[model samples]
Target: MSEPPKERVKYIDTNLNLPYHYYAGDYKALYLRALKDKKILGSRCSKSGKVFVPPVIASPETLAPCDELVELPHRGIVTTFCVVNVPVYGREIEIPYVVASVALDGADVSLYSLIQECAAADVHMGIRVEAVWKPDGERQGDHTDIRYFRPTGEPDAPFESFIHRL
Candidate 1:
């Protein structure tokens, strides 16, 4: 006898409210707290001599634990970037802004941030930029404390200066 036909699967759409809380551990807690004061904190791996911004507990490249935390400057080079022309949900900024990988001075790894205060066309790899921080009272001890990075008008960084971070 022939077997009965199998049931066909149907798809349904639904929305669920998922509430969550994030807890930044010791290292991230220190990093986020520093943001409230407009400071960038980085951790250095003694073994590899590499520094990481948004400080991680261990070096990603060397798998070595980092105990030395240092403050980093806001200035950096735009190692790479992309101009956003598309819109997405929950986007707080307008389109046509440049999002870039910034290699802050003294940090071995590059940090990502929005590039502003200049035309998108003016943003290019190796451009020198500085963080534009929000007022101290307005800081929330988070990434939002940094409004954006703007051109410093300094000469572009030497390729050798930031090429490794890229």
Candidate 2:
């Protein structure tokens, strides 16, 4: 005899509210706190000598402990980027803004950020940009303290300068 048809699987659409305290452990706490001063921080891998921005506790490449703190320059090179034509929720930015992987000076890893103060067409790999920070009084110990990165009009860095971070 033929078996009865199996029930179809179903998914429920539900919204759950989750609120909790975010604890930034030592490595990240230091990095976040430096944002208030308009400074960027990185953690150096003790074994590999690589510096990572928004510091990680360990090196992703070598799994070595990152125990040293290093200051990074807000000026960075755009390793790669894309023009966003779609709108982001809660952000009032005009469409077609640029987003990029910024390889800050003295850091081995790159940070992702919005690129502004220039036309999207002008943004390209190796373009030099610097952070635009919020006014000090409004600043918090958060990455948001840097409103965005804008063109510095310096010459573009050569591919060799940031290719590893890409």
Candidate 3:
């Protein structure tokens, strides 16, 4: 009698090393340039007076044209977040790091970034945070210029203020 054939493998789990570049258009190019100058810029919609970080050409919500690029404060509020247990391919950070969506003080929109300088357990929605920039000489005209966001001692935002918009 023939032995039962081995069950076929149903899945394979592995990581792929895919290198790629994000096509940055005019608006994004301007924003990325400002990073080299240690400035944070947001696009403002003339119609709604809403500003978006990592400036876009139009407002995602209202679909209004954003013609103005305004400098934004480095401080922002944590709108939401998740603790990441999986390690990044080349980054050396330990497992269980916090990735958060930060709502800059003046911008209506939020940008996602890493959270550091404190335990992951303490990260939460509405927590105030300030960007920790790489030293001037180390900046390379990219989001990497801002190493991470660290908690600010200031009070957390009132949920009502941001909750209404989200």
Candidate 4:
């Protein structure tokens, strides 16, 4: 019998490395502390009375350095969300999950994160959520320290309750 043509495999290489001199200011430290304790922290603008998570160093409106660090409630309500069926490079997660914007209690702005432990079909706008924190030793002082948010067994809050925070 004659030998059939052999197919050749192909590979592509892209060199990538962590950036040098990555800096996280005091606000980052505060965020880390919150993660360690299974709490959410936000910075409140003293003048405009606005709160920001991932705690901005300056007020988005007034452009002033934020002074007050407020610990937000673990519970939150989903403001918006999208189902992610495609995975990107360097992403350590499963497919078909929901990426949601959650407005934590007592904060003026919503934060973006993954909504896990449920089917993508189950995710919806205005669903109640709670932080699923990592164990103390597992925390790495970054947003991922919380792992992901899971559905909280609570009724969704009225839209009016969180509209202003958006």
In candidate 4, residue 45 scores what lDDT? 85
Task: Go through the candidates in order and give each one's C-alpha lDDT.
Answer: 0.91, 0.90, 0.89, 0.83
lDDT (tens digit, per residue) of candidate 2 on 73-153? 889899999999999999899999998999998888899999998899999999999999999789998878999999999
Candidate 2: clashing pairs of residues: none
Q: Write the per-residue lDDT of candidate 1 for residues 49-87, one digit (tens) a residue.
A: 899987888887889998999999999999989999999
In candidate 2 the C-alpha lDDT for residue 34 amounts to 89
lDDT of 1: 0.91
lDDT of 4 at 11: 72
Local distance difference test, candidate 2:
0.90
**Candidate 1, which ten residues in sequence have the lowest lDDT sum?**
1-10
Question: Cα miss at 49, model 3 (Å)?
Answer: 0.6
Give the top-scoring candidate (lDDT): 1
TM-score of each: 0.89, 0.87, 0.83, 0.80
- Looking at candidate 1, what is the lDDT of residue 126? 96
In model 2, what is the error at residue 2, expressed in angstroms?
25
Among these predicted structures, which one has the highest TM-score? 1
lDDT score, candidate 1, position 155 = 94
Least well predicted 10-residue stretch by lDDT in candidate 4: 1-10
